[model samples]
Target: MLENSNNTVLSEVDTFTNHYPRSSIKRITRYTTLEELHSLANKPLLSIGWLIICQDTAIKNSYLKFLEGLDQSNLVLFRITSEQKCSELLSALKADKVQYRIINNYKLKEEKVIDYVCKNLSITKVDAKYLCTRSGYYLPEVVKNVQTLKVLPKITKPIIRKYTEDRRSIAVYDLVNYLIGIGGKTTYEDCMQLVYEYRYGFEHLLKTTLAQITVYIKIYNLILDGELTLANCKIKKKDLQDKEISNLHDFRLYKIVESFDKISYDYLILLQLKLQQISPKFYSGVFDFVALLKINAKPGVEARVSTKINTKISSKVKEDLKTSEKRLDEFNRKRYTMTTDDCQKAFEYLKEQRDK
Candidate 1:
């Protein structure tokens, strides 16, 4: 009776083991020199196993290639076409025709895939796998070391603790003020630094690569939302200052009603009158020289000789006066006078000079 009990116990154990589904494993051998498939056939423990769960053949091929290049030990490639029956996969494994002993059971596939990963890769749970995949950054040996794997929990904590954290949302007022502050003056290097600082300070929960993309997307959206008016943006500080000064000068000039040509002519005439009034000593000296020349003329023919000498001197003076007038005209053409206030100040100074 004891021997009969032992046989029944053994049968029960066998039945339980057989009822457990087998893991589907696909062995992807990396080729060296694109020719030898078995040249580097060593396996490393992949902390996670991924079942290529995509239905698209192109996606499958691309994922297969991606996995084949990834660490070879953790990778298993399986294909499930719509036409292929599940029994065929079992038969292939039973006949030992599969390169790897893992078989894909469509009924409990998702759980089976997770189970196979945890079993073969020596990982504790499926959450680690999800974190790594969602990170979008390629980390080949993240699961190889236990210490590095701990980063996954910290990374996922933000999602669970979302309510406790003060989330940052881009406000329209903030966007407008930021644009007005830097706007066209912000260089590419400045933008890069700003993005880095923003990510490090406010977006510590997000992955670096994702944070960068998110920042860029926000900038693009701000532009699309008409928050930033770029048509008149000045990228340089000097350029902005120069434009402001130019606008002020134009405004001042615009307020003056008199035409510049008429103003210039009136200014020249006023300058000539001022010169004539202020230089009396110079005019007196010239008059004295002419009188001396007339007095020193021949005695008996004093009037006639003095007239001839005066006529000759007057002719020479006329020529000199013509040259001086030409020079004065050129000066007036090139030089500009100050505005009404400056002219009043000059008149006051000339009156003081005359009084002295």
Candidate 2:
């Protein structure tokens, strides 16, 4: 996705706005402190989704009856981890309503899941005990996904994938990193080149609209209003080619970091001009400045809530969500933006819980 070479010739732009590839240390350093980023994984650490599949008619019907037996306030949260779930699961039973709930990792324990599965699945205690001890430690969803593998395909290779999460936080951290790069007087070509190189990871972000790019725009408006200190940060190797940095994991990230606050404003004017020259694709969300930011802020793991008829959701979900807001006199449902599909799934989950 590199632009035709006519415009990206780094020399055409002044040194303030343009930058060449820097040491992996310098690039990774510009991101939030090093303890947070990662190698590629399809799941965004910030989401709480679920994966539920019951191939056995008895298990499926039992789980559905279980859903029909719940109380509304005891709703479950599912972080649907797989964006590509259609091909992976339920291809044979495509018409079956897919159920999900968002869950937090702090609350999901292996022992608890094993206990729940043992009591619910009517399987031999030995098999239940065996599954409870499976060794894949990537995410709790890995366990849930494993349950479906008898019918679903096991991943034999590493695949690049994307999904959406925590828009505001992502925007803030990413914008700061971008601002730091520009303030450092890095060339625009290098910045654009980085996004092009790691386009797969950012494919979803690039499709998000700018209005969704909230925190950064609010800060950008504030910068114009002369409120917060705007600073530039830098590091890149001018000679590295597209072919050289193809393997991102090799981008040695074990370097030091300076917090966003520490970067200086020495190159502000140059940086301002640099922002002016950025293409509209970034504005339209066709490109994401975040490819350079490198990691999701606020990492979260997915919890797969099985939505079969007899499957019972543990009371754990309500215990977390139903709390009195200290400022509010009464406990109120927390408002969250969810797609219609997610809302309907939630509505069904609530109906199951509430109708009984």
Candidate 2 stretches greater than 4 Å from native: 1-144, 148-203, 207-214, 217-356
Best by TM-score: 2
Q: What's the TM-score of each model vs. the native?
A: 0.14, 0.21
Say which candidate scores most in lDDT. 1
For candidate 2, give the lDDT: 0.29
- Report, for every candidate in turn, its global Cα lDDT versus the true structure: 0.31, 0.29
Give a tens-digit lDDT track for model 1, residues 1-356: 00111122122223323433334223332221232222323332342332222222233333344435545334343334322223343444456433444332322223433343344443456544543333211222222322333344443423423312111223322222122121223332233223323433422312332332333333333333543223322222124333322222222223221111112222223333423333123223223211212222214212111121223434533443444565455435333332345334544654453233
| Deviation (Å) of 249 in candidate 2 | 31
Which residue runs does candidate 1 get wrong by more than 4 Å? 1-356
List the RMSD of every prediction in angstroms.
Answer: 35.4, 30.1
* Cα displacement (Å) at residue 257, model 2: 20
Candidate 2 total steric clashes: 42
Q: Could you tell me which residue pairs clash in candidate 1? A: 23-102, 23-103, 24-102, 24-103, 25-102, 184-235
Candidate 2's error at 232, in angstroms? 27
